[model samples]
Every structure is written in C-alpha cells, then in structure tokens.
Target: MGYDEVARSVTERGELVLRRRTGTDGPAVLELRANGVFVMDTAEHSSEQALADAALASVEQPRRVLVGGLGLGFTLDRVLGDWRVEHCDVVEIEPALVEWMRDGTVPHGRQLLADRRARVIVADVATAVAEAGPASYDVVLLDVDNGPGQLVHDANAALYDVPFLHVVRRTLAPGGALVVWSAGPAPQLLADLEASFGHAEEQTHEVRLQERDEHYWLYVARPAAGRPEASAAG
Candidate 1:
C-alpha cells in the first residue's frame, strides 16, 4: 500500500496535491490534500451523500441547487440522483482541482461534469453567494471547508461568520434549505446559523472510515418565519 503522486499544483493559497493509493488490501482511493492537510478522499462519503439527502428532503421542490465545494464529486453526485433537480451549480475555488476532476485525475470527474444538469464555477463560494440574485436557488450546500474548527485556508473562516451567512440566506428561495457540511460539532457555527436564518438545527451523522468511527454534522437552516410565503418551484 503506497501513495502515487498523480498531480500537483500550487495556487495562491498553497500546495494542492492529488495522490492515488492502490493495493490489494482494498479498492484504490483517491486522496486530496491542501497545504499538506487532508481535505477529502474517495474512501467513505456516506456523510457527503447525507448532506445532499437531508437538504433535498427539507425542500418541497428542488430545482436549482448550488454546491459550495466539489470534493471528489460525492455531494453533487448525490444531489443529481433526484429527478426533480433540474440544474446544479458547483463552485470550487481551486482551478487545479476542477481541472484534475474534469481531466480524469479523479476517476468519476469526467462523468460527473459530463452531466448536462451540472455546471462547475471556479471561484470563491462566498463571492458566488454574495453576487447571486435574491432567491436564486432551492438548495445551497456548503462543503467548502472542513468546519469552523478545522480550516484548510485561513480565509475560509469568513464563510461561517454572520455576514456571510446572511449572504447565503439571501440566495435561498422561500421554503428552501441550506445545509453546511462540518467536520466537527461546531457550536459557534450553529449559533451563527440560528442567528442568521431564525431557524437552525444540528443533525449528527456517524460513519466508519479507515477502521475508525467519525462523526459529521449538518447545520440545516431555513429563512425566518416572517419571510414571503411563496410556494416551492414546480
């Protein structure tokens, strides 16, 4: 069992590397690293799938979706499973990662992007959310960083702040849902979501990976009760 360096790139943030671990012990895994920190891998992504599942279930009609991160394409893949999802916009800050995925460095990258319903935007998610029109999406997912506690980039801390959260809220349609994938039970993040959305709850999901148990949190939030009462998109 060894890791083969498949691709490497240095962005303004730091070093990003993609490695392939192959051996008879199990199926090969593709790992992504940012600034020497483990970001995500193709090992166990039940939580990722759950992130999309929980969001989709919250909304009555899920047509336009925006994914904050494109980690191994797990969350996006799960979102597209629902026939109701007409279009999904994926925002990834790293051009190299998107290139790697689209160019087959990641096994399912091409097939995932090839989906006509999906589009990838190479830009900061915070910027994307802020510039987006009001009530533009039915579902907005944030898997950009691990969590507020563990950040791959120092700048990503803004994503969890109250101002940015308000920006996120503005983009969600009436009755829409926003799900943030966190690595830990970030109490501060939960509070911020509650403050911004007027309705926020923490749902915990556990998964076993590399023979160890790990817990992930999804901070599900909706707009305040006093907002307009438009019906979900048909």
Candidate 2:
C-alpha cells in the first residue's frame, strides 16, 4: 500500500483548506482535496474528460466554451483537444488552486494553460456566468462541485437552482449545450435542469477505483428555443 502525504496546502477565499496529496506510488497519483473532501485526483479523470467530450459532441462547430472549474485541468485539456474549440474561458473560484496548476503544483496542469485559446479566470463561476452576455458561448461545461449531493461548499447549492440555471441558459448561444459533472446521480438537479431547459439528459461514466467500480454523472441540457428569454422578460 502506498502512503499518502500532503504536498501542499493553502487556505482560499471560503476559508476552506485546499490540499494536494502525493501518494507513495509517485507524482502521478496526486489528489486535490478541499476541506477534507476529495475534489479530484490525477489518477482517474476519465469522467472529467468525458464531461467535455459528451458536451462537445452534442454541439456542432463549438467556437466558444466556458468551463466552470479548473480542477486538475483534465476537463479543460479535453475541451481543447478538439480543433473546433476556438476559445475556452475557465472560471475557478480559488486563486490558490489556479496558481497551483500554473506553478506545477499538480502534474498535467500546464497542458491546457499553455493552449492559446484557454483563458483561466480566478473568480466565482456563478458570477462569471451570470455576468456574461446572452449567447456568449456555444458550450458551458461545469465541474465545479463534487455534485449537488456532495458539495464542497453549502453555498454552491445556488448554482443548481432554477434562477442560476436561467443565467446559464442566457449565456449559451442558440442551440448551445450545458454540461455538468456530478460525483453521483442528483435527481433533484436533473429535475431542475429539465424544468429550466425544457429538456435534459443524463450520461453515466464508470470509473474503476482499486477493486470497485464507481459511476460519475453528467447532466446535459439545451436552452429551450424562446423559453429562457420569455420567462425573464415576462
């Protein structure tokens, strides 16, 4: 068995401790934990990449993308993999997390940051999304929390509510797609997305951890033709 050690730790805006762990196996087995909650690890990030893939696949010729959370940079790297992706605006709430990735605190962190089309924004994702103009992006990919069921912060609950989702809807261009990565199935979140988007679909990705199989959920939604604007206008 490999023993784990804290490689680095920092207290961010929310007063939560963000930590990077290194396992005995080597640097490849690094994990990011927030307030003792496992945010993500570099070991198996297939689900993160899957979130980007599934979202991009749903749209054609996605020019501008918004990724809400940097994590280990897996989702951002996957988004930049496709040539059709022109620009990606990544919003990560923790400046320390962003700096960690920039300063090589995590392996594979520089991949997406080096891409010309990638822009890393250290701010609250919800605020960034809400402030964006209408039809600003063709794809909005979110991997901000563990899931609605397991949030790193309680305040993140607002991001899954109807009102914030409405803001997300307006930020997407006509026919644009919104993809959210969840640690597990969140029925209420799905229901909210359906009500807000007029349509929602769930895709599950199986991840192998040691001897067991774990599943991650991705909820994809598209803005209903005129519903978003009409609701806000009315």
Candidate 3:
C-alpha cells in the first residue's frame, strides 16, 4: 500500500492534524487530534449530499439559500446542482479553506467558486445570519463544526442557541427551512429548535468512508409565519 505526501501540524488548540493529497484523483484528507478525524477525500460525499437533499425536500420553489460551511464544496455543489436554487450564499470562516477550493486543491472547486449564481462570503456564519435582511432567504443550511454538541470552535455554540435561532428564523422567508448537520445526536439542540420553529424533526444517517463508519444527524427546523411565542436562551 502507498500514500501521498503528508503535511502535519497542530492547530491553535493543540489538536494534532495531518493533510494528505494523493495523485490528481485523490482529495486532500484532514486529520484532527491524531484520531483520523473527518476524512474529506474526493471518493464519496454521501453526508454532504444528504444535507442538501434533506433540506431541499422541505422547501418548495427555493430561490436563494445560505450555506454555513464550504467543506470540500460538496454541500454547495449539491445545492447548485438543483435548478430550483437560483442563488446561493456560502459562508466559511477559514480563508485557507476558501482558497483551497479556488486553487483547485479540491475537485470542482474552481467551477463552483466561479459560478454566477453562487457567492462565497468569508465570515462567521452567525454574524452573517444576524446581518441578513428579514425573510431574505428560502433555505439556510448549516454544516459547520461536528454539531452543536461537538463544536470545533467555541463561538459556534451560540449558533445553535435560541437568540441565533431567532435571527435565522427572521432571515428566512415564509415556510422557509433551516437545516443543521451534526456529527452526533443533539437532544438539547433539537429542543431549542422546537421552541423557536413551527415544526422540527431530526434525521439520522450512516457515513461509510475508507477508514471507518460514522453516524451523523441533520436537524430540520421551519419558522412560523407569525412571531415567536417565547424567548429562551441557548
């Protein structure tokens, strides 16, 4: 067996990491904390596809959508593949990840980054939602971090909270949907969604990769047409 060149380093939080890039066909793999965490090679992207597919199922005639993370451009690519999606705004905090997509480090990055219908914003997903105009988007999909429970960054915790959920609800058009991708089950997050939205549901799926089998969750929430009945801190 053989492997490509590997670049190893530690993040600010002291998480040991590795990046492996094989031949032209291989996608870069990012390993966190020496646990072989989150392999994002180009072979398969069932989870990303699932995020887009699940969100699209609940939305009707969705024109504009906001994607919280741009990992491997798979979720964005899947959303752009839909003809119903006229415009997409992708927010990613890591400039390097955005540049990777632009420089072809990831396959299909160039095409998706340059598409007129898509706009990539390099900023925090929470701030982006807060600043968005009321009822501006038809769908909001969040795939940042592992999930509400296993957040990669501390700031992301607030995103799943009630106040942020309020902002997200305000940013969506009537009958619009908010979808979040989680590495594991988040019962508290689910309860928060129930308090803010008209209808909320959780979906679980299995992710099969070369090294291991992983289970993930997608929490779908929809805003009510009227105002929120109560306010709860996340």
Candidate 4:
C-alpha cells in the first residue's frame, strides 16, 4: 500500500491531518488524523455504523436522535437510513472537522451534511447533552474518544463519568437508549452506565482492519422506570 498527503490544517482542538492512501490493489482511501492520533479512514467503519444500529434497535419508532462526534458522518448516515428517524442532531467539537465535510475534504462528507434530517452543530457534545430538555430525544449515540482508558483529549474523560451519565439519562425520553462507542472494552464505563441508568447492556463488534483484528465495545443503557422519583430521594 502507498500513502499520499492530501491536506493538513491547524484547528482549535489540535493539528488536523488529511491524507489519501493508495494500495497496489484497491481504491484510494482518505484518512483523518488529529494531533498525530489515528481517528479513522474511509477504508472501514463497521463499528461506527454499528454504534447507530445497535442504539436505534433498542428504541421503537425513534423520531429524534442525538449523535455526538461526527466522524466522517458514518454514524449519522446510519441513523438517517432508518425511515422512522425524523431528525438527527449531531454535535461535533471541531469546526475544522465539519468544514472538512462541508468542503469536500472527505468523499461521503457532502452527502451527510446535505441530508435534511441532519442538524450539525459545531460545539462540544457534552454541552449539548447538558442543555437538552428532558425527554427530548429517543436515542443518544456517543463516539467521542477512544475510550475512558485512552482518551484523545483529557476533557473527554468527563463524558464517561457518573455525573454526565446522569445528565444523559435525564435528557433522554422514557425508555430512550443511550449508546456509547469505545475503541475497546471498558468495564468501568459499563458500571457507570448501569449506575446512572439502572439498566445497561453492551455489544461487541469484531472487525479486521489494517490486517489486524480489532474489537470495539458499545454500551447501551436506559433509565429505569420511575428513575426521576428514585433520584429525588438521593
């Protein structure tokens, strides 16, 4: 396989790198890396799509969906695939990342940005969760960082905490599901999810990428019945 430089930019979060890679066999692929960290590429993203599919599966006729971290628009695209999804609200922290999509830096970028149901917001996802009204959404999908153990940004760790999990629970509609994507297994995150929502489950996606098998984890949780009443006493 051969790699070529496409473009690079400096953003508020960190250095953003874009590249086009070509192999002896197969199509040229686009890559996005942030601060020397490998984010993802056009080559494969089954796990990302799984994040949406797994979350949406748990909800019935989900009309409003909240998506955190717009990585190459895979998760958002998957959410929009469902006819039942009426609106998809996406929160991305980096303006450059969104611009990369809007300006055609990525191949499938424009398609997602142009989707009528997609509402892209260039701001911290955590802030959006905190500001969301109670029972505002049917599903919340988050793929912010690598995982709690290996965060691309230190501030992202806050999203996995119990307090933020409570906020996520509070923002969801009754029986709403919150799905989080992690690079690998995160037992602590699972415990936090269960502690906040009172019920949680995980799904693992195993994929072969870059000639190696990788396992990713998705934690899905829903607030227990009468959770608000239970919280009132605590």
Q: Which stretches of candidate 2 lie over 4 Å from their true place?
A: 2-7, 12-28, 226-234
- Candidate 2 differs from the real structure by a C-alpha RMSD in angstroms, to one decimal, of 2.4
What lDDT tens digits, residue by residue, belong to model 3 across residues 47-111? 88999999988899789999998877889999999999999999987676677679775556898
TM-score for each model: 0.94, 0.90, 0.85, 0.95
Residues 1-234 of candidate 4: C-alpha lDDT, one tens digit per residue: 777878787865678788888874678888878788888888888988889989999988689999999988898999999999999999998887788898888867897789899999888998998888887899999988888877888899999988788888877887789999888889999998888888899888898777789998989998888765233112
Q: Which candidate has the top score in lDDT?
A: 1
Which segments of candidate 3 are over 4 A away from where they belong?
1-18, 21-39, 225-234
Clashing pairs in 4: none
| C-alpha lDDT (0 to 100) for residue 35 of candidate 1 | 90
Better of 1 and 3 by lDDT: 1
What shift in Å separates residue 36 of candidate 3 from its native position after superposition? 8.1
Q: What is the C-alpha local distance difference test score of each model?
A: 0.89, 0.82, 0.79, 0.86
User: Which residue pairs in candidate 1 have backbone atoms (N, alpha carbon, C) closer than 3 angstroms, thus clashing?
Assistant: none
- The deviation in Å at residue 200 for candidate 1 is 0.4
Q: With candidate 4 superimposed using the best TM-score fit, by how many Å does residue 181's alpha carbon deviate from the native? A: 0.6
- Model 1 shows how many backbone clashes? 0
